[model samples]
Target: MRFLYLLRRPPYSGSLAAEAIDSILVAGVFDQRVSVLFKDDGVLQLLKDQQGQLLGHRSVNKMLAALPEYEIEELFVCARSLAERALSLDQLSLPVQVLDEVGQQTLIAAQNVVMND
Candidate 1:
């Protein structure tokens, strides 16, 4: 099955982001095709040089880096979101396909299931 995971919240804001990552990893184990899209403050989850993190939490950057290993290579981010935050694609922790607003809509339309966090 094709699953699109839309991560729209900032990482480590409680358990949502971590749960989403866990879901993606589990989906891969079941041989499901999974793609992740970062939107809104979720794009902040990709910023480089993430430091001074809160105590008792796993590294968001580390989990992001491990996505490809789980065979979840179709990572995407909203171009407008980055621009609004005054960030460029190069500033992201990992490389991803950048989609404008319309492109994001098309992607959502194409997904069989969409999970927003």
Candidate 2:
């Protein structure tokens, strides 16, 4: 089955992002096709050089960076979101496909299930 996770929150802002990570890992473990799209403030989750020490929590980036090893290689980020935040693709900790608004809609429509965070 295909699972699409739509992340719309900033990283480490309580448990939302962490929960999404758990969902991704669990889904991937079960041999399901999984993909994640970072939108709005969620794009901040991909920023490189996140320091967990400063936040007194483990780096969410650590888990996010492990996606490929977990067989979750399809990472997407919104182009407009990044642009609005004055961020560029090269700033991300890991490589990700840039999706425009229409691309995002198409991806979500094709998913068997979409869980939002």
Candidate 3:
């Protein structure tokens, strides 16, 4: 099955981002196709050189780095979100496809299941 995880929360706002990552990993482990979309402030999760350790939390970047090992490589970010935050793709920890409004809608519509966090 194809699973799309929509992340709309910042990395350290609370535990939602981490929980979503955990869920994605689990889905990947079960051999399900998984994709992740970083939207809104959730795009912050991809910023390079974040220091979650300063907040006594495990590094979200490090956790996200493990996605490739699980074969979950379809990562995307909202173009408008990044532009609004003045972030360029070069500033992110991983290479992600930047989706505009129409692209986002098409991608979401192609998914078998969409889970938002």
Candidate 4:
């Protein structure tokens, strides 16, 4: 079945991003069709130069890049959200579809949708 995972928080804040990534991995293991939408501050998690090593933490970028290996390729990022934060697509490493307000609505109208806190 087709599924969408909506992420709405930044990674460094807490485990929300990590948990979402884990869920996506599990979904992949089960052969479920999964797509991700990084909205709000969640878009920050995809910034290309994440340096968690200095903070003694693992980087989510590595995991983010692994999505394709897990067959989760349909990645989307909220254009307004990214722009509000003054972030550009060049700052992110993942292959993400830039979605405007209209696209976001169409995305949510999919077969299944999941939101991350």
The local distance difference test score of each candidate is: 0.86, 0.91, 0.93, 0.86
How well is each residue in 9-107 modelled by candidate 1, as lDDT tens digits?
887788778788888888888888899999999998888877625546777777788889989899999988888899997888898999988998999
RMSD of each: 1.4, 0.8, 0.6, 1.2
TM-score, cand. 2: 0.96
- At residue 116, candidate 2 shows an lDDT of 90
Candidate 2 lDDT over 47-85, as tens digits, reads 989997698777888879989999899999999999999
TM-score of each: 0.92, 0.96, 0.98, 0.93
Top of the candidates by lDDT: 3
Q: What pairs collide in candidate 2?
A: none
Q: Rank the candidates by TM-score, best first.
A: 3, 2, 4, 1
Evaluated against the true structure, the overall lDDT of model 2 is 0.91
Q: Higher lDDT: candidate 3 or 4?
A: 3
Identify the runs in model 3 with alpha carbons over 4 angstroms from their true place: none
Best by TM-score: 3
Q: Report lDDT (Cα) of residue 37, candidate 1.
A: 93
By summed lDDT, the worst window of 10 consecutive residues in model 2 runs over: 52-61
